[model samples]
Target chain A: AQSVTQPDIHITVSEGASLELRCNYSYGATPYLFWYVQSPGQGLQLLLKYFSGDTLVQGIKGFEAEFKRSQSSFNLRKPSVHWSDAAEYFCAVGGANAGGTSYGKLTFGQGTILTVHP
Target chain B: DTAVSQTPKYLVTQMGNDKSIKCEQNLGHDTMYWYKQDSKKFLKIMFSYNNKELIINETVPNRFSPKSPDKAHLNLHINSLELGDSAVYFCASSHPQVRGGYTFGSGTRLTVV
Candidate 1:
């Protein structure tokens, strides 16, 4: 079984300040990680995904995450956050063997809600 | 056009009244899925269909059923709606290889009153 844990339930950051959301996962096989953002009353939008590549992967809206194997972490980071960045962030992990089917399904963490202040 | 779309974005109905949520994906993906997000924001998979065939069925109750008419549409039908069934239902689609991850719909918020 695979699981993801996001320690922070709520995060507050001022505009123009750097932000980092921590995500940790436990998977027995090769893990495919993903970050998704959701606004209030809206659907989830993919921020980025890590399958197999450079540890640092860049995503839209000036977001990036690094996959740390030894630490079992894939933390999302941004140099500076904007006011519009206030949303709920979710971290998910799944083991996609050679077949690309999630061992069963993707496991998601308790989302972290971001509140960007002026 | 929305790649993945769901109908009845906001549905409010009395308890015990059955309802259905429709989902369609324009993307040429081979797989479609249904997920439920509880009030506390925990997401769990309910069902998954691949190539119009049911592939994954979680421990959901028999009252909750998913119907995939074709490869591009998967609809959720809930019978004897209970208060516990009130939540945001999301529809998603993806290719088998995890190419670009999955595409999600705008979600339908079901309120059982």
Candidate 2:
């Protein structure tokens, strides 16, 4: 079974400050990790995803995440946060089976609500 | 064009009534999924279909049925809607091993009165 845990339920960061959201996962095999943001009344938008290789991956909206295999974590980071970056963040894990029948059956963690302070 | 689109973005109905939510993906992905986001913001997969074939069905109650008519559409119908069923339902599609293939539709907020 695969699962994800986001330790921060709510995080408040001042605008222009750096931000990091912690995510930990448990999977027996090579895991596919992703970060998604959902604004108020909007659907989820993929921030970044880690399939394989390259511990550091860059995503849209100036967000990036580092995949640390030893730590079993893929934490999202932003050098400088913007006010519009406030949203619900979710850490998810999924995998592609060898047969390739299904994918994106993600196991998501409890979302973290990000609040940007002016 | 919206890659993944769900109908009736907002739905409110009385308990014991039945309703359906329709979903379609124009991205040409063969796999589609349904997920439920509870009030606490915990998301869980409900069902998944591949090319109109049922592939994954979680512990969802039998009252909540999923139907995939074709490769592009997956519909969810709830019989005797209950208060507990009031939550946001999301439809997503993705192709295995394809970068940037996964896409999610604007969720349908169902409020059971």
Candidate 3:
């Protein structure tokens, strides 16, 4: 089975400060990684996804994540944080199967709560 | 035009009661999924349907049943709900073959008293 772990339970950063959230996954094959953000009482919105390509993938709202196969990590980062960026973030890993039916099934990590200060 | 939408943004009911949540997608995607977000905000896949056929059924309790009337709609029905079943349920749609990311609904918060 595949699983995802997010080391940080909560992170607080001041506006204009850099931020990074850690994520690690355990999967056998090439895994599809994704980052999602969820505000209070709202559904998750996709931040970015990595199937196979450049190690650094850019996403919406000026967020990016790097896929490090050696460390089994896909860490999300932002050069500067904004107050509106405060929300719960989740990292997910998708298993690959021959039939392509497993692509939509995502195993998500325990979310990390991000708090941006003024 | 909402890409994906789920009805009943909040559902509060007593234990042992039955309830259903409806989901619909307008993005013409062929795959739809149901996910549960617990109190701690941990998300887990519960079930998936592709082209109106069941594809992935996680190790969820049998009390939780999913029905897809067509490719565009998937409804979740829980029988004899328990307090443990209280959580936010999300519906999402994606094109599996195209490697596109999922478009998620606003979510339905179910609270069993």
| 1 against 2, candidate with superior DockQ | 2
lDDT by residue for model 3 (A14-80), tens: 9999999999999877888999999988889999999998999999999999999999999999999
B13-53: candidate 3 lDDT, tens digit per residue = 99999999999999999999999988888888899999999
Candidate 1 chain B lowest-lDDT run of ten: B94-103
DockQ (Cα-based) for each candidate: 0.58, 0.60, 0.65
Q: What value does the lDDT take at residue A103 in candidate 3?
A: 47
Model 3 misplaced regions, further than 4 Å: A98-103
lDDT of 1 at B65: 88
Prediction 2 TM-score vs. true: 0.97
Docking class of 1: medium
Which residue pairs show collisions in model 3? none
Candidate 1 per-residue lDDT, tens place, A6-80, comes to: 999999999999999999999887788999999999999999999897989999999999999999999999999
Candidate 3 chain B weakest ten by summed lDDT: B94-103
Q: List the pairs of residues colliding in candidate 2.
A: none
Over the stretch A2-116, how does candidate 2's per-residue lDDT look in tens digits?
8999999999999999999999999777888999999989889999999888989999999999999999999999999999999999999888666653455788999999999
For model 2, give the TM-score of chain B: 0.95
True contacts kept of each: 0.42, 0.50, 0.60
TM-score for every candidate vs. truth?
0.96, 0.97, 0.96
Q: What is the lDDT of residue A15 in candidate 3?
A: 99
